[model samples]
Target: MALLFWAVGVLAYLVAVFHRQSLSVAGLDAAERMGVSEAGMATLAMLQLLVYALMQVPVGVLLDRFGSKRLLLTGALTMAAGQLVFALSDNLLYGIAARMLIGLGDAMTFISVVRLVNLAFPPHRNPLLLQLTGLIGQLGAIASTVPMIASLHTYGWAPTFYGAAGVGVVMAVLLIAVLRDKPSGQAAEPGLKAAWTHPGTRLGMWTHVATQCSAAAFLLLWGYPFLVEGQGLAPQTAGVLLATLTAVGMVCGPVLGYLAGRYPLRRSWLVLGVIGSTAAAWTAVLAWPGHAPLWLLVVLVVVLAANGPGSMIGFDYARTFNPAGRIGAATGIVNGGGFLASMSVIALIAIGLEVFDDYRLAFLLQYPVWLLGVVQVLRYRAKARRLLAQLDEGLGEVRGAQEPALGTKALD
Candidate 1:
């Protein structure tokens, strides 16, 4: 049953992920057809992300109250409806509404899966399981790239989106049929009061949401532009490159999970800081007009790969401290925070590019933001370590007392 649930979670993630990437492709096409400015397109992206981020907390709460299966069904249906609107629309307002729906519908899959994995697996196995699941979802991103561009080329964006909408309905049906809220014999309602009341968990959740939000913003401002314009890669090449970024992430996910498992959070962040800094610097160098040599694009692709895992480590850190029963809500909070940060940054950058008329400089400026986030993560890690040490000492004292009691009972 656990394995079955895991499979369902993977499928749910795939469906949500497919919709997420499809939008980027469709949005790019829409902008091209409408003669929209870079800033305008980014503004549209801002809408999509803002709605998505804003919905995370509420969605998390819903998942906790209503259960994963029901929420998953809702997400699937909502996404399909959003795509239908997107397929039919010709203007930005319609596009905005469609993207908003996509964001809302997209909310349920990833966070819910994290909760499901937490429930289905043991504590020690969770980090790896999440990393594994991330890999599966990356495949969805991959599909969006070359495969999506090919579809868009062959049938046009409208048809592709409509087809995706049909797929969404199928996914909704599957969720309604098979997914379950809790495993048998572990049945107990996960109450809203208890889930919402934990201060540490709530803080941890917001921390995650902020971090991921920032990462998303950074990726859009710097990474997406570099691929679309700076490199002057065709849409198909850009899509393939996009796919490569996530595909490499699939590798980084498990490797980082192993590192988190082996070392403490602070140590892991220090290493990530170094790697992410290198990635940022290298990406900047590659993105610099005529500065990047022949191999620069390849190097940038590798760096782009690190972005996904960089955020995942923060998420792993959050999960470590979360209360067992509140894991779903906690995951939602963390995810929401990260995405919210991303939306804010994307909106700001979109505004900046219009004013400055130079995207490369605007994009380079965003790199420092990630470095700053890394510092925050390091600080959080140090604080977590101190707290954990205190917890260990307290647990040791309890164990020491219990050991003597057990020995005395043996003598009797």
Candidate 2:
């Protein structure tokens, strides 16, 4: 039963991810159809992210109040409407509005699904389930690559997006029928203050910011163009690379999950490792004298693939520290970190591209954001660890006292 519920939640999240990443493969076509410049296209992606980031706290509050079922259903319908509008749009303004709607809907999904996972699964099972959720959800991104590109080429724009929107509507109907808020009479706390007060939440947020933004920026809008135009790869080859990015992430998700479960104390180290690897990979590609070799590009893609799973570590921090009632808001706050960072990177890259006409220059902007995030992660990791130690000491004392009372009762 738990698996069945989780599967449905995962399906909704999968569809949401597909909608989120659909624009990735369609960048050039969207530019052509909307008759917009690269910066203009970036605006579409940036605005979507902005909307998504801005909505996280509010949506978290709503999720706590209404439960995952209501939020998931609404999210699906909203995304379906946005995709329909985007499909029919012929100008930049309409595209912006459509993307905004899509962003709004996208904002409601992953956190809700996460809440569902928390409700349906056992505590020990959550880390693996969460990773599996991400792994399966990334299949949506994989679909958005070659399959989406092929669809755009075969059926053109409107019809393809119309089909995409139709999928969302169907998911909405399924959610109405099958999804539930909790197993039975589960209660949720509705305060954001408690979640926000914890150092672990902040640590998770910074971890997310550090780990996720670069990959999000790449996969969201810039990567395909960077590959095709900058590195001079063929469109087909670029699509394959993008697909490989998703595939690699899918492969890494479980391994990271296992590591996270086994080495909860060392999770921060794992995040730092992923960040270092990402920075190294990007530096190698961007600093290469000319077009990087295909193998080097492959290595870069493989490294970027770790970002998504690494970011999931942030959520584990939130889950570890917060009470059940506060999980939704805490997850929202952590989720916002990456998107907020990605928004800045996306916007800056857009401006850089417009100003310098160089992908290398645009991507260089990722480093500062990364540096800032790494610093914060270190700062908050220390604070969170201190808090956790105190918590453990307090818990030990309580258990120590209770053990004496139980022993006396047994002896009597």
RMSD of 1: 6.4
The lDDT leader among the candidates is: 2
| Model 1 lDDT per residue over 300-376, tens place | 66665665665665465355445556555556666776776677667666766777766565555555555665565
lDDT of 2: 0.85
lDDT of each structure? 0.64, 0.85
lDDT of 2 by residue, 1-412 (tens): 7788789989999999999999988999999998999999999999999999999988887776678888889999999999999999999999999999999999999988888877776665676778888999999899889999999989999999999999999999999888766433333444578788887789889989999999998899999999999999999999999999999999888888778666555777899999999999999999999999999999999999999999998887777666667778889889987799999999989989988999999899899988998898888867765765555522111111211211111100
* Model 2 ranges off by over 4 Å: 182-190, 388-412
lDDT of 2 at 343: 92
Task: Give the range of the ten consecutive residues with the poorest summed lDDT in model 2.
Answer: 403-412
TM-score of candidate 1 versus the correct structure, residues matched by position: 0.83
In TM-score terms, candidate 2 sits at 0.92
Q: Which segments of candidate 1 are over 4 A away from where they belong?
A: 183-225, 265-275, 286-291, 385-412
User: Least accurate stretch of 10 residues (summed lDDT) in model 1?
Assistant: 403-412
